[model samples]
Target: MRRHVPGVPLQRWLLVSALVSAALIAGCSARSSAEGATHYLLTDQPTGSEATATGGEGLLRVQRIELARYLDVEGIVMQTSDVAVRSARNHLWAEDLAAQLHRDLAQRLSNQLEGVRVLDPDQQLRAPEREIMQLTVTVDRFQGRFDGYAVVGGKWRLLDSEGEIQAGERFQREQALTQDGYPALVESLKDAWTSVVADIADGLGGAWGR
Candidate 1:
């Protein structure tokens, strides 16, 4: 047997529905605003934005770049122990890890090489023929360690357009944390990357001078 139910007045039902809708809207707005508040930082200075001139010696194209599989995510990772790792919840990469690394490497090298035209992957696709040399890099370690150090280790190869290898070597470096927190970690990471760039530029020898 069905029991007769009292109906809510039309105006009261409409008011109830509006309240529910408003609550949902506010919740969604808060969530989206929180997500937008996440922080993003580059590992090195952007030479392109520095108003530096280009096209002096030759084009150095980034043929390929690969980041560790675990670090392929948007969140930054830190190895808290040998067997454990932690990722930042509110701190994140604004772009793909490999792509950002490639851009930073290309631009930093460009700044150091003077006349070299750095062709990041995007630019490489546009002017393949202009690239006289290629650089391929693989990042093996790129994370904050338990010891309060930001470590970066990788291998790179510089090759001529003819595929002849010009320079090929491995690089590893770390920046000691001055204090604590993500900002310090990021600064340390930048320092580590800067060290790697210095070595890579040195490997180029007189390539920059030419």
Candidate 2:
């Protein structure tokens, strides 16, 4: 027969059970906190608020936007050194970076260039009679630098409907972050990108015949 052993006292058992439950709850809470991430959108306003059309005006298709491989990831990238970089573990893009760039650039172009409607890669159908021009861009660098500046480096070319290059140039811009952190970095990036759009608009003015 099994020897009769003193069972844990009722009060002691209750206290031990409560302690175990509390420990489990704390563990789960810590795990949840560790796994949660914050997402940020590139645009200041909602995506739906971004207007892609200029009331069927002159067409300018923004296409062939190639971003650096490192920048294509979900998290925002930061250049730790000339040869080293790291992506944020807790901060991430709210949408695809490429798509967000295209849409936001197109919308900015539409606003910058009068009488010209901007079309992004998403626009598949072309207007039959409207003259079309395209802007192809390659972004080599788009990240926060260790020097505490947000940088955007790239090249853009304007091509006519017949696939002839009209005007193009290599460009790079940097904006100083007013404060630290990812939000400030993103804002500086937006300002830098807007400067790029303004340059493109100026180029378009000289390149387009109409």
Q: Point to the candidate with the largest TM-score.
A: 2
Q: Per-prediction count of colliding residue pairs? A: 2, 0
TM-score attained by model 1: 0.69
TM-score for each model: 0.69, 0.74
Candidate 1 local lDDT, 73-168, one digit each (tens):
776777654576656655667778777777777777777766666665655344444546788889988887665568899899888879988877
Q: Compute the lDDT for candidate 1.
A: 0.67
Deviation in Å, model 1, residue 196 alpha carbon: 1.0
Clashing pairs in 1: 56-115, 57-115
Regions of candidate 2 where Cα sits further than 4 Å from its true position: 1-35, 46-57, 122-127
